[model samples]
Target: MSKKILVWFRNDLRLHDNEMLVEAIAKSDEILPVYCFDPRQFELTNYHSIKTGAKRAQFLVESVAALRQSLQSYGGDILILNGKPEELLPALVSEHEIAEVYHHREVASEETAISTQIEDLLWKQKVNLKHFIGHTLYNKEDLPFPIKDIPDVFTQFKKKTERDAIVKPCFLTPDAISFVTVQDWGILPELSELVVNEDIEGLSQDSEFKGGEEEALNHLHDFLHTGEGMALANASLKKNEIVSKLSPWLALGCLSPREVYWKMKEAEANYGLKPYFNQIVLGLLWRDYYRFMFKKYRNTFFKPEGFKQELALVPLADSELLHSWKTGNTGHLLVDAMMQELNATGYINTAARQLVATYLVYELKVNWVMGAAYFEEKLIDYCPASNWGNWATVAGVGNDQRLTSSFDFQKQLKIVDPKGAYAQAARA
Candidate 1:
């Protein structure tokens, strides 16, 4: 009997630097790749927003479609299904005689819960489930300090890790995959099937961002070689031009952070790491910090108080206020413009994100979780740790040492968008 393995695709969607996929290929005679579109992700949240709104749903759809195509090119096909993994995997194992399941480990509470449920189910069938870490720039084991001892401050964590920790080289993409035949490789779900709003088409059509590994690599190359690299390194540079805009692909695991890190290192060697390349590495470091924080804090990271009890009164959710913020009708030019851009393109630069989040939590006085939840729905690159952790920090409950943090929208507008180019473009 041949050893048949199932590669479960989750947040880590790309083939390049995919450890789980490589492991499956090495250990099994036949591999079956699978992706599940869990219905729960598309449901409404407590904040009355669809958990996965149309913009993100469309991106996800595009990503999965690309994954399937990539697999097919390797002479393998991904069995894309619309169901919970726990309910679906057991049947797949039984039908295909799958001997093992391999996947990337997810530390977030909800993802961990689902993984645990699937593990228990697979265990009952006497099949093994293996998990590998592929999300962060640095492996947890390679970190200079233990996860529990990871510095609560970003600068402290950044310094130690940059000085002491080592980033392992990325895994190789397989040349060809030997696939086990799957009869019911279901079709990718349409936006309407995912319960996405009809208005998404109009919003996404004008947006240049597309979801796929190919696109991710292309963006990386363009950013590094084509002067976009220099823009990424300069903090004083405008958001529209300076940032790499790689977060969406990174968030979806369509691109590995390790690949990004290595590429940036190459650029640094040639260009010198003074401002441009150093800044890019700093951004990757910040992402790793949030992931480690999630591992250390777990579900507490999502709470309004966020691993601390210092906040006396977390704001209650206000439907009208949230609606105004979400719709970009809050009457603050900069905040409204950022929100409009986010709603339409499912993306915004880090500065814009911080400004809008600060406005929602401070000026509008709405609960931070509501704003976070909305971001979860809207962002093309929404990673649980980075999104919620940043929200908590801005909400005065996370790792920031300061008791309160708020951005001055007008002041930021003057500095970053003096002539209001961003605001004007967003409105247009």
Candidate 2:
């Protein structure tokens, strides 16, 4: 009998630098790759937003299609399905006579719950489930301290980790994958099927951030080689032009953080690019910090009050205010423009994100979670930890809680949207 195993695809969607996929290929004679479009992701949240908005849904659809294409090129195919993984995998195992399951472990509670459910179900069949950590820039084992002892402050974490830790080299894409043939390979879900809003066609035209590893690698290469990558190191550039627009790919695991880190270092060494690339690395560090914080804090950031007790207060539930903020009708020119861009493009600049989050929490007095929830629905790059963790920080209740006064939005307005160009473009 052949050793058959199932490689479960979650957020880590790419063929290159994928540890779980490589491991599965090495361990089994025949392997099946599976992706589940969990219905829960598309359902309405308590905050009254679709769990997955149309723009994000469309991106995901394209990403999965790209993954399937990559797999086919490697003499394998991904088993795409649009249901819960726990319910789908057992049947797959039984039908395929699979021997084991492999997947990258996740930190968020809902994802953890689903993994736990699948593990228990697989165990009932006397099959083993293997978990790998592939998402963070620094692996958990390589961290200077255990997750529990990681500093609650961002600066401390950054200093200690950079000094003491190292990133593991990314795994190369496999030479060939021997696939176990299966009937009924599933179809990718339509954007309308995955989102609540009936009108999705009009917004599907923006090519600003198409999904896939190909786009990700291409963007990184061009950005690092072109004037945009060098100017920040050598000359001053406008804010919008400075952004690489790689977050959406990073969020969906189409681009590995490790790959980004290595490629940036290579670009610096070979081209003598200025230390400005370190700023990009710093952003990746913040992303890793948030994920590790999620493992340590364990659902505190998602609480109605937050991780701190004394900071507790009743959140404002004004529908009109929340709607105003969500729909870009808040009357603040810069913030309204930012929200409008996010709604249309599934993205906005980092500074704009911070400004809008602060506006939602301080000026509108709406619940911070509501704003985070909306981001979760809309951001093409919405990683659970990064989105929620940043919001909690702005709201004064994150792992790295700020001790300063609320942002002077009007002061920031001049700095982030200087001369109103970003605002004007957004409105146009």
Candidate 3:
């Protein structure tokens, strides 16, 4: 008899170049795909907003639906459940007699805790739990320096890995697996049910950032195979649109970095490499480096005293200033506009993020952790390590040598958007 396996889908949402999915297929003839909405993610935090807001929830629902459709074409169907994994997975394993569970590894504190607990639970049930790193182009075990010994500065980390680390090739899965009996469950929660206080402007945007494996794959084809590659690369370097707007998908695991990296290599070999390729890949390195830092430093990443005591002067929180910044009402049009864009779409460009954080910490003297928590609630691309690590860096708390740095809004607007195309779009 073919072995029954549960392939638990977390953030790694896509089917392409997905190591966990590939391993599950190689091991079992019949695979039951599972995705849990994970109730804790939907609940409100001390920040007084949802941990995962409506915009992100809408994207997730769309992505999960797309993943299910794709899996169905392969003789497997995605089982959707809403609850804690600790309670749900045990019931699922018993119900399906699942012999093994396969998933990608997560590095955040909460996610790591869940992974460890799940590993122990599956062990008790005698079902093998398998994990593979899917979010990074370069895995931790493949890095030159030991993860614990990873440098405390981005430049140092980047310098070491730029020369030393090699991106491993991604795994691919065949089109189909044999049919398996999945205990029929009903409809996954729609965007309306999953989100409360849906009346905000963020929910009504005409700009669509829908989820799913096919959409992400199509985006890849459009970005690389089309003429937009040079444009995006240029935009990314200048903190504009020339870059691949794939980070949200990457963050949510709708697309794997390995798939993107290989595609870049193929394009470079064909058309000659662009300067943008190296810079964008450096962005990916920052992602991996922060994840390693999080594992090494733990919850300290979220605090103002990140990975060290006596962080250079702790900035006081100015509630009035923060509220203005959050609502996009700050007098500075660039900073306010960026905040407005984020509030409306739950996503923002990397450059805009740094500028806004710089204004908050150095200009307004807002508490760093408060800003990080607000981002956690709002950003669709919110990865704990990247988000927290980045916030700490801008606030002079994380792995930077500088005592502090502040952004000059007027100077950036002139340099990055002299004609104010982005600002004009924000108004529109």
Question: Which candidate comes out best when scored by lDDT?
Answer: 2
Off-target runs (Cα >4 Å) in candidate 2 are: 233-241, 316-318, 403-406, 418-420, 423-428
TM-score of 3: 0.91
Error of 2 at 15 (Å): 0.7
Give the TM-scores of the predictions, in the order they appear.
Answer: 0.93, 0.96, 0.91
After TM-score superposition, the amount by which residue 405's alpha carbon in candidate 2 deviates from its true location, in angstroms, is 3.2
Model 1 TM-score relative to the real fold: 0.93
Query: Candidate 1: worst 10 consecutive residues by lDDT?
Result: 232-241
Q: Write the per-residue lDDT of candidate 1 for residues 104-148, one digit (tens) a residue.
A: 898889999999999999999999889899999999999999999
What's the number of clashes in each of the models?
Answer: 1, 0, 8
lDDT for 126 in candidate 1 is: 98
lDDT-based ranking: 2, 1, 3
**Cα lDDT of model 2 by residue, 1-428, tens digit:** 99998999989889889999898889899999999999999898888687899889889988989999998888768898988899999999999999999999999999999999989999999999899999999999999999999999898999999999998899998998999998777888777778786378687565768888898889888888876886765667643447778889988899999999889898888766645567788889999999999999889989767777886575546489899999999998778888988988899878889899888888878888899999999998998999998888888787665533546667567768768887787666
**Model 3: which residue pairs collide?**
13-253, 63-212, 231-242, 232-242, 232-243, 233-242, 235-240, 235-242
lDDT of 3 by residue, 100-139 (tens): 8888888887898998898899899988788888888788
Candidate 1 lDDT for residue 277 = 64
lDDT of each: 0.85, 0.86, 0.78
